[model samples]
Target: MATDDGMRLAYYIVLLVVIGGAMLFELSGRGGKALRQLVLWVVIFAGAAFAAELWMNDGLGGRQTITSEGRIEIPASRDGHFHLTARLNGTDVRFIVDTGASSIALGPADARRIGIDPDDLAYVGSAMTANGQVQTAPVTIDELAIGDIVDRNVRAWVIDGELDGSLLGMSYLRTFARVSFENDLLVLER
Candidate 1:
């Protein structure tokens, strides 16, 4: 583990010990009832902690269901965004589904990870973003796949600005015959 992670774990352990000790001291006179209450509280705290950890790790919202009928269902995250994982040139890439975006736009890091050199690309194209206008470089993904669905020679752009993550925009979403929101899930049918 990294130094930061070790320190965080130690801090939580120390906090739990201190809290447990305080609870024990407060319940000393109550005997068996106090012990039961303490155990109950511990179980509740542990359950809450486990749930928080799952939410932080994207365990709850990162699940994508691909049906045999070529339909992909994505759950909306707690943050109210739909995220999907697709293979870009055979490399796994995570993207936030942005219907407002005209095309698939990759951040510098993602572009580099999928074997594209951002430094070598000429940023001749430009895009107007929420922040401002930013330079972009047009690139074609050799293969983009999500489950059994695959598209080749897909048009995309590399954004020359700070982007938290790559975007799965209308350019790619248009490939699906139907894109709809059912209940809380985003459904895309090819």
Candidate 2:
């Protein structure tokens, strides 16, 4: 094993030994109670670790599903926001569906990923965001696709300020024949 892996294993082993020794000392006379407490602690730690793993893997966002009839269903994330992954210029980009946003907004990182250079764009437009007015650069997305649906020459803006992630706003949602939220799920029909 690599040095780092070996060291980590050693650290975990040491931790287990220390914790086990302490538990044994504290529960020297109570056999049944000690076993029950140990089981409870194990369950608690296991549950916490599982939750951390799920959060790190974005499992909490739930999964986006596409139907055979070309309908897209997005489940609300734990934070109560609908998020979906779409192809922007053939590059996978994660976006949060924001009804308040007037147009599709791309963060600088996502803009660059889709072959748009933020440095080359002219920040002539301004947007009123929650953080106040921010400079924006208008651009045309060569292609934007969600599941089997695709659109070309899509108008979007690159926000010249801090953005957690890209925003999929009304600009694209308007194309859907039907957009509705039911039971914490956002459904988009073409």
Candidate 3:
């Protein structure tokens, strides 16, 4: 996040310099054609500069910005998924926001990461997954936080089967007043 702010400041500084230079040239007896040419070059330079930043910031997407005012904006991953880093039980956990999922699903590895013992959890429940059916165990998250949004005692399931990572499902997402996708951004508002 600090890196993003620094990059933004640098971009603005460059933009200001370019604009100032163009204005100075325009004031120095530049004709309409010269003004037009300056404008075109400025546009091209700005586009290229932004393009370079985007390329450096994960193909122009991913958590490029975050707000403290009950809003979090995340850019789509290269794979086109809205993956976010959330605090689960005070630990940073990566999750893929899955609206189709009924509840937050944690893999065994993730469960352990959050201090839950998978061996002690009883896999009494089951869920129908793309890979047929998988056994699941109920678990409660002490706290889950995404940016300024936080929810306590959140219900989640620990899958006894294989999974790549934890899923942030409707159980947590529905708590938000709004969840939307615009362009390549995922906007979550309280």
Q: Per-residue lDDT tens digits of candidate 1, residues 59-173?
A: 6436788898999999888788998989999788989999999999999999999999999999999999888999999999999999889999999999998987899999899
- What TM-score does each of the candidates earn? 0.73, 0.73, 0.68
**At residue 129, what lDDT does model 2 achieve?**
89
Local distance difference test, per candidate?
0.86, 0.85, 0.83
Rank the models by lDDT, top first. 1, 2, 3
Model 3 vs. true fold: TM: 0.68
Q: After superposition, how far is residue 141 of candidate 3 from its true place, in Å?
A: 0.5
**Candidate 3 C-alpha error for residue 69, in Å:** 1.2
Q: Number of clashing residue pairs in every model? A: 0, 0, 0
Off by over 4 Å in 2: 1-49, 57-61
lDDT of 2 by residue, 1-190 (tens): 5364487467556656656765665557555776757755765575576567568545643678888788999988878899898999989899999999999999999999999999999999999988899999999999998877889999999999898789999988999999999999999999
Which ten residues in a row are the worst by lDDT in model 1? Answer: 53-62
How far does residue 27 in candidate 2 sit from its true spot (Å)?
21
Q: Judging by lDDT against the true structure, name the best candidate.
A: 1
